[model samples]
Target: MKKVIMGNHAVSYGVRASEAKVISAYPITPQTHIVELLSEMCANGEIDAKFIKVESEHSAMAACVGASAAGSRAFTATSSQGLLLMHEMLHWAVGARLPIVLANVNRAVGPPWSIWTDQNDSLSQRDVGWLQIYCESNQEVQDTIPQAFKIAEQLQMPVMIVMDAFFLSHTFEIVDIIEKEQVREFLPPYEPEIKIDTADQHSFGNLAGPDHYMELRYMIQEAMDRGLDVIKKVNKEFEEIFGRGYGLIEPYRCDDAETILVTSGTVSSTTRAVIDELRDEGVKVGSLKIRVFRPFPTEEVFEVLSKAKKVAVIDRNISFGAHGIFYQEIKSALYGRTDIPILGYIAGLGGRDVTPKVIREIADKAIGDEQPERYINWIGVKI
Candidate 1:
């Protein structure tokens, strides 16, 4: 059924469709509505689930961890500092191999205080072993929840569904809401091989000694290594059933393009418009939206980008001293494979608007410069 809803409610509907058994979250700006609606659904019997209201984001995730450990489909939502508070439990979810799904509205981390969109919060948890999917629209955001659950259960790893704060979270759009009946066709009930059971008890996340610790960590890496294929398989199955498929990396008009812009989240939509405008004027530029961040999609990214003359990455999140997070990943992916000039542009930090003019400027620079003057470039910064 089609319904006009904001991104947060879209997430709630996704969780509803996924039939998550345990929904636990602490209210945080931009992300609160996601769980708020789920709470309502639970209360009204629209969803047969337990909506656990917790005090802090830490406790929210801890509650999810406990629920997921008990072999239930678990979920939660948070943004910015709320996400940061859940850092410890996030690692716990990954290390324990519990298939808990989290919807993280991408908000900028605060010092001076801001509730706007950015990738820093989720990016900061990059190495924690969660499969991260960044959504471009409310429809994708809603669809990804069930997909994330399927992917997580199959891999026995947690998944994070990330969306831009306010941009995708507060903004209303028409989404073809995937009903629970349809989702059940694609994502089956999660049945884990081993779970915390009282009758047939098994030790989970027990202390790992020096002899076995390395191997445990090795297995985690192994799962990550296999994540891409599993995600692709799940995506294909979802597309077959739902008639919509979002690949790991979506390359638009890239077959014969000279320059390609890399982006994620809501920025990808704006970048696509810029690409079309530039294309009409005879500029051979394309855009690549990275839907999946973890598992990196190195081979797929390389294949699409190697054909381009220049590549520019527009990052909404930066890694302090190093460079843009996606920029680093893109460069690493294409490092030895191709020496094409891959430029990195840090723009739209702290919810600043990444307008077409800004994207156009980056594209023009990338296309105009035979060799980029610097690896890292900042856009729309005041002195």
Candidate 2:
């Protein structure tokens, strides 16, 4: 059924459709509505689940960890500092291999205080063992919940569904809400091989000594290594059943392009429009939207980008001294394979609008420059 709803509610509907047994979250700006609707659904019996209201985001994630450890499909939502507070538990979820799904509305981390969109919050947790999927639209945000569950359960790893703060979270759009009945076939009841059971007890998150600790870490890395294929398989399965599929990376008009722009989240949509405008004027430029960020999609990214003459990555978040997060990843992906001039531009930080003019400027610079003198370029900064 089609319904006009904001992105937060879209996330709620996705969790509803997935039939998550335990929904636990602490309210945070931009992400509060996601749990608010889920709480309502639980109270009204629209969803047969336990909506655990917790004090802090830390406790919210801790509650999810406990529920998921007990072999239930678990979920939670948070943004910015809320996400930061849940950092310890996030690692717990990954280390325990609990398959909990979290919807993180991407908000800029605060010092002076801001509730706007940026990738810093989620990107900060990049090394943690969680499968991350960045959504471009409300429809994709809604659809990705069930897909995240399926992928998580299969891999026995937690998944984080990320979206731009207010851009996708507060903005309303028509989404073909996937009903629970429709998703049951795609995501079967999560039956883990091992879970907290009183009758058949098993140790979870137990201490591993030096002799076995390295192997346990090795197993986690192994799962992450296999993540790409599992994600692709699940995406294909979802497409076959639902008539829609979002790949790890989406390359638009890249077949015969000289320059390509890399982006993620809501920015991808705007970048696409810019690409079309540039194309109409006989400019050979394309854009690539990275949907699945974790597992990095190195091979797929390489294949699409190698043929291009220049590649520019527009990052909404920066890594302080290093460079843009996505820029670093893309450069790493194409490093030894191709020496194409891959430029990195940090734009739209702290929810600043990344308008078409800004994108055009980056594109023009990338195409016009014989060679980029600097790797990291900042856009729209005031001295």
Q: Write the per-residue lDDT of candidate 2 for residues 129-175, one digit (tens) a residue.
A: 89999999999999999999999999899999999998999999999
Candidate 1 residue 207 C-alpha distance from true site, Å: 1.5
TM value for model 1? 0.98
lDDT against the true structure, per candidate, is 0.93, 0.93
Error of 2 at 214 (Å): 0.9
lDDT of 1 by residue, 1-383 (tens): 89999999999999999999998989899898998889999999989999889999999999999999999999999999999999999999988999999999999998969999999999999999999999999999998999999999998999999999999999999999999988889999888878889888998878889999889889889999999999999999999999998899999999999999999999999999999999999999999999999989999999999999899999999999999999999999998988798999999999999999999998988888765836578998896
TM-score of each: 0.98, 0.99
- What's the residue-level lDDT of 235 in candidate 1? 90
Give the poorly placed runs of model 1, Cα more than 4 Å off: 370-375
